[model samples]
Target chain A: MSEKTLTYEQINDELLGMLERPHPSYFLLLLGFLLALGLFVLSLAIQIDVGIGYSGISHPIGWGVYITNFVFWIGIGHAGTLISAVFYLTRAPWRTAIYRGAEAMTVFAVMTAGLFPLLHTGRPWLAYWLIPYPNQRMLWVNFKSPLVWDVFAVSTYLTVSVLFFMIGLIPDIAIMRDDAILKGKKLKALIFTPLSFFWRGTNHQWLHYMRAYLIYAAIATPLVFSVHSIVSWDFAMATLPGWHTTIFAPYFVAGAIFSGLAMVMTVLIPMRVVFGLEKYITDHVVQSVCRVILFTSIIVGYAYFSEFFIGWYSGDVFERSIFYFRPFGAMKEWTLLGDQSIGFPQVAFFLMVFCNVIAPIPLWRWKIRNNIMAVWIICGLINVGMWFERFNIVGSSLQRDFLPSAWGSYWPTIIEFGITVGSFGFFFTLFTLFSKSLPAMAIMEMKESAHPPMRKETHG
Target chain B: MGKFSGVWASFEYLDETTEAIEKIRKQGKQPQVLSPCPRHEIDHALGEPQTRLPFISLIFGGLGCLTGYSFPAWTASDWVLPVSGKPIVAIPPFTIIGFELTILFTAIFTLAGMIGLIVIDTFRNPLPKGAKKYPRFQRDRFGVVVSCEPSQTKEFEELLKAHGAEEVHVENS
Candidate 1:
């Protein structure tokens, strides 16, 4: 028997039905959020009143969990604009399904990323001092700082992405405008109205939309690539032995996309259930993204080896010593100081190989890719592995730099861990609200996806 | 006075342009067939009429390319100093930057051209304050708008009737 199609009323009734008691998982998710939020607040407040000086942030490991989280979050944000604009322009059809959610996630994630650096600052209020405000202080912003470049790059990338996302929404707003189902409802239309930009979806309007989408995609592609590479430049620009390398740009960018894709899969799991949109975003589409994961995994693998090979080939002792010390440093001191790592680099290499390289090999097979449960499980492991990979690169490297005296091991303090979880809470809260409210997928894009303009049949 | 007028239908999902051409040939009517999607097939169906769109795209794409590269370069180079030890003006990096700008300009220009040519952006639903013969068009609906000379309205209406039009109406515009 055919299941009766649920009308807008039924869907709404079901949705509204849940609001009375909140979600079954809502209490748990909320409790986690509160605990995390409280811890983050306490951490920052203590630090601000006292200082990041109070934490384990010492000389050699200048950047601790704060900066690491910042980089990781920003990297995760990369895949969204990359999918929306870059993939769209290239005519990757699967993009229409997953791109919207990821794009929204991108905006929120960037916002989350922007928070950490500020929190980690010596004076949070004076953070604006970093920007060159034309106040009478006669103070000039440092033009030669990678941090300065980051402010501009990340902000510009965010602005352009928001513009692009809003531009795409204009036609849909018109549809919603005429839709009787949406009569007398106002859903923060203030944000949406500017986006609509008075779009009417007429032939002329469509023409404009098509042109805008293509051009924006084109502009955004490089911006997306540049943002993460620039983020890596923050590390590469530093004079640290392992961090300062030409290979850092490509290496960081590849790792970014690798982790970013894993995130996309993780987000997709919850989104599929809540939106009742399994059909719109299918297992086949989910599996197709694994190919991206596989490809990026290999590239990151090459970059990892490439960095080590280059270090050996160039015969740079400082670089070699730092690399060696990361994992198998002569820890005759028997302390887990920066000096006492038991093969951190080797461990990093194998762990990355396992998580990013080997673990994904099962996905190459058709069965595993198609298995929704297995896909979700793999995507979860992939995310955990990605976090570890970042730890190995940033954390371990910080603990074991060229100067052993300055080097020290750093772990995320209670507050540090809390803030990280808080960021996740913020991301999820925004995403959950977005999914529940907005059309989970782009209806217009999906409509067009199944029936694109056909190529003319050729005759010899 | 302009001569031919009639209605036509085509399988938009499957052989769209040919079906349109065959229908037009049978009636021998010089009617217009505006499709939801712009395709080369439609151009063939309409005898591949010359349009200034491609030229517009080229000109605009060029303009976009120029601006995308130059604007950022100028801002980062002449207007601003180098953020890192990197030079005041970075050219190699412009490959992605330049490419993106060109696409941006082309899109904007194309939009302007579309509004200027198709005249849809100006359409505040000017036909009537609340006229909706086909609300479905707001969603997934597509069609060929078969417009002919006003004198041939009767035959055109009949032709539209014969081709199994779900609905038909006269346009005030």
Candidate 2:
């Protein structure tokens, strides 16, 4: 429907209708994720039983796929906040339709990211020790550790993102509740009534709600930058060659937004199709998101070059060695299949470059960016590339440290692979269920943007 | 059922709604406007000051920052563990903790204040009986609810209809 022809009631019905009956494909998708989750659980069970050593992490390369997945998932959450909080503050109109889905993505992605640390610790039950509580021993978590900083940052990000999301959803949920009452869907009404907090859209509620929402947007904007910066500190504070650098903060933030926007597209393109939100999620919005992806891709590409340039320029032998060994195999001498010689580190490096830098270059052209299929495929590549990017940083740096004698290769076992897949399953499963249950688009905001019904022309 | 009652009028258009609110205020009575979404025009017509929730957020945010910094500083001083010859209480790292908590507390308290104010307003100026029965006010319509006596119900309804109200109801309980 054209913007002019769209009425408030139509906007309400179209957006809220998504929460009604689901298509079989949604259940199929949910079921597929559940199976992956089951695999994740089984893998966790096996790892806990057999110990964390069952995974590919060994001497010299302690932080492996789990840390990479942790960073990757955390990075995936940034685009949602960027869209919801940052874009909202800037009064970006296109964000109105996409922000809700992106905010939901942020909440779910953070929840998924929160699990990896627990999984990595191997003793999930004792994870509470990370909290700075006064225990029987009078011991507190070290305030100086970046890991502790990460705990504060990620948990805070999760809480703030959830509040921002729910604050945005309140008016829409109230609409759903009213609709449920109108339709006599008592179960849905029963569920949404409390969620709506007895919202009646009185001027009293909207006055405070609008002010509070703006404050949320303001606070959440800095939070989006801080959470990932703190996550970067997890690496930058380390003494490792490739991992320790001043640029990691901005570089990781850029990469996080890049991967996050890709994941948003990865989720939203399919969602717009499934929910018939093509009108709201128009080509303009898709192209706008692509432009951002392209811009962030350039920053990531620059960061990569800058890392190498700084490595060679700094004349730090260890840094130069790690940088050199990243692209060229540290174990190039090992031959396989009668003359074929390839190292996993080299392969990961090349894959990361190809996915992160080269894949998104086509988005500069309007035609290519406009092609939904092409954009979707590139987004998928960006996702893979981002994971490999984290892998290259986490794995390649550790595989060859300062002491050559300490150098060792890391390969993920089946259990690690299962857990990684399970993480995706966990993220998508919650996302799919969320899309079905909540207003996928900000309905009230859309109406607020559109021309309200007016009969008399009062310019004043 | 009480000495005071309410007259609820629903307008199909924003112009008429705001005009009615302006007229009601001119008549020396406070009018509550209900809208599907907030409008600057309605705010202008009602002339209520901006919500003070931001002050609440700022106060809580300051407290959070103090707590975040002090908790870590006090703990480090008490424990007195020396690592890498760094300061007993590192300011740079603790700033990260402080910053995060500032935002966290600001957000939590902003929401709390908004909810608290909404609850207080709901009790103080409760909606008329079956006010929500006109659900259009939650979707398309704008509603102007004014306090009036049972004797003034007809006069208020006539005033609302004159201002192009599509529907008007009076509750004398």
Candidate 3:
């Protein structure tokens, strides 16, 4: 099933054939996610009803699981644009098969990421106050605030990603429209017609389409770097020891790309199997992605080492103490059940290190990277590790900030855990729906990469 | 077929399609080529100018950058709220807003320009009648459509067949 053997017709049938009918397993998987979404909704309802106090976020550890989830989800989104825009600009051919899914993942992950800041704001309804609209009070959002920057950065990322995704879909959707008309699916044709924007594949339309798409990729490339850098600023701009550092921007960006590539593998490996896209999403593509993940993982590990090195070398006691506390901090006497507990922050630090750094080292081997199951498992570990990485950064830094009396352990409540699980449910639900509804792979791009059908003899 | 005077030719091969387009062009007709995907060969044969989308994006993106910085500066000045002993309008911090807005505005208006140009072209040079019947043009086939007088339609159809057109349809007025 080499891509070289695939003609345009075969590619169309294999790709578009995915949208034709769903297997029962698809429904079952969707149902599982919907049930999880129900848990998310139930948790949100309780939080809104009982007040934000129900969550474990207390005085010093004000940002807990919600903020961690926010950063984690946003990090997960970075790979999409990285693969779509960055790889596109570089002319990476392997990107054609898998980037569409990555782009979709980005949109959904960002959509999920956006919920946290709203959820973090005890009154989600007044979230609009972050906007700089004129009001009777004549108040404006402090542009100097990193939090305000997050608001602008995240919104702009979401908008730009969606537009880029839809613009890429036009030519493919036109194929879907034609396929529907051929099958005499009047209903589908009616729906796809407008979605395709009446695309006729005319040279006039394509000339402009090509230019516009290139411009989008160009703009979006910078956006991918900026959004995450700005997110890191939310911490870096702060004066807190571990939270405030110049290295956070690049460190966070690398960690984001690391985690995001892992998430892309987490979704794509399963999708490639389920949709029978072996020829398109080949092992070469998987290995290429693994190399990126491995490269980024090295950067993340270096960032971790540098943070510790700087803390020790800079002779800043507060920084030195926070770095020490991250791994060997004392646990609070009280736990979720009012019992003595192990040091959760230390455990988080170790887990993050083990998952983010140690787990990915196996991928350095050619055989290991080629093993899809092994790659998938390691990717799962990276996902867990990356989340703990954020948890460690957000929770541990705040737990023991400046004074002894201010030191307190942060443990997520049952409600917080529920919402976290629910976020997964929401993300998966949207993704599963997207897989069935749209062309998960970029069809036209695939054809462009393939050897076009040519006659044996040229006509003079 | 009243008031319809054109010829539509379909080819199964890319080279043949480009060859057909070249042959049609040599006869003083600027034929329209349709493809399932963008091809450098077709673009070369068509010889259209580079698109103006970049200019649109640049103009709007610059506007956005100005507005992003100035709006925040003006608001901070009007309100006169200063924190952390920073200036009333900090250029460094506002630069983030400017950067984000530059990308946002560039993307939105670039999209608008693309759609606007497509719409204008669609109205000015609508696809030939019976083009919809050749849905293969959207999937696998390549098409060469030429508008001509009824007297010349037969000659054009023969030219298309001579150059490896798998199918040719004549539209008559």
What interface RMSD do all candidates show, one decimal each?
Answer: 7.2, 0.9, 1.0
Which 10 consecutive residues of model 2 chain A have the lowest summed lDDT? Answer: A331-340
Question: DockQ rank, highest first?
Answer: 2, 3, 1
Better of 1 and 2 by lDDT: 2
The residue-by-residue lDDT of candidate 1 on A329-388, one tens digit each, is 555553544345455445665676688777887888989888877877777777766766
Report the lDDT tens digits of candidate 2 across residue range A1-460: 5444577888988888888888788789899999998998898889888988899998888899999999999999998889988888888888888988998999999998998899889788899999988789899999899999999999999999889888999999888888878888889889988999988998889999999988888898898888888999898999999989999999999999999999999999998887778889888899999999999999999999999999999999889888988887653443232323357777888999999999999999999988999999999999999999999999988877777767788889999999999989888888988988888889999888777888875452
Indicate the TM-score of model 2: 0.97
Candidates, DockQ: 0.16, 0.84, 0.82
Please give the C-alpha DockQ score of model 1.
0.16
Worst 10 residues of 3 chain A by lDDT: A331-340
Q: Candidate 1: which stretches are off by over 4 Å?
A: A1-51, A130-140, A181-198, A273-276, A329-353, A451-460, B1-120, B123-134, B143-159, B171-173
In order, the Cα lDDT scores of the candidates are 0.64, 0.88, 0.90
Top-scoring candidate (DockQ): 2
Worst 10 residues of 1 chain B by lDDT: B124-133
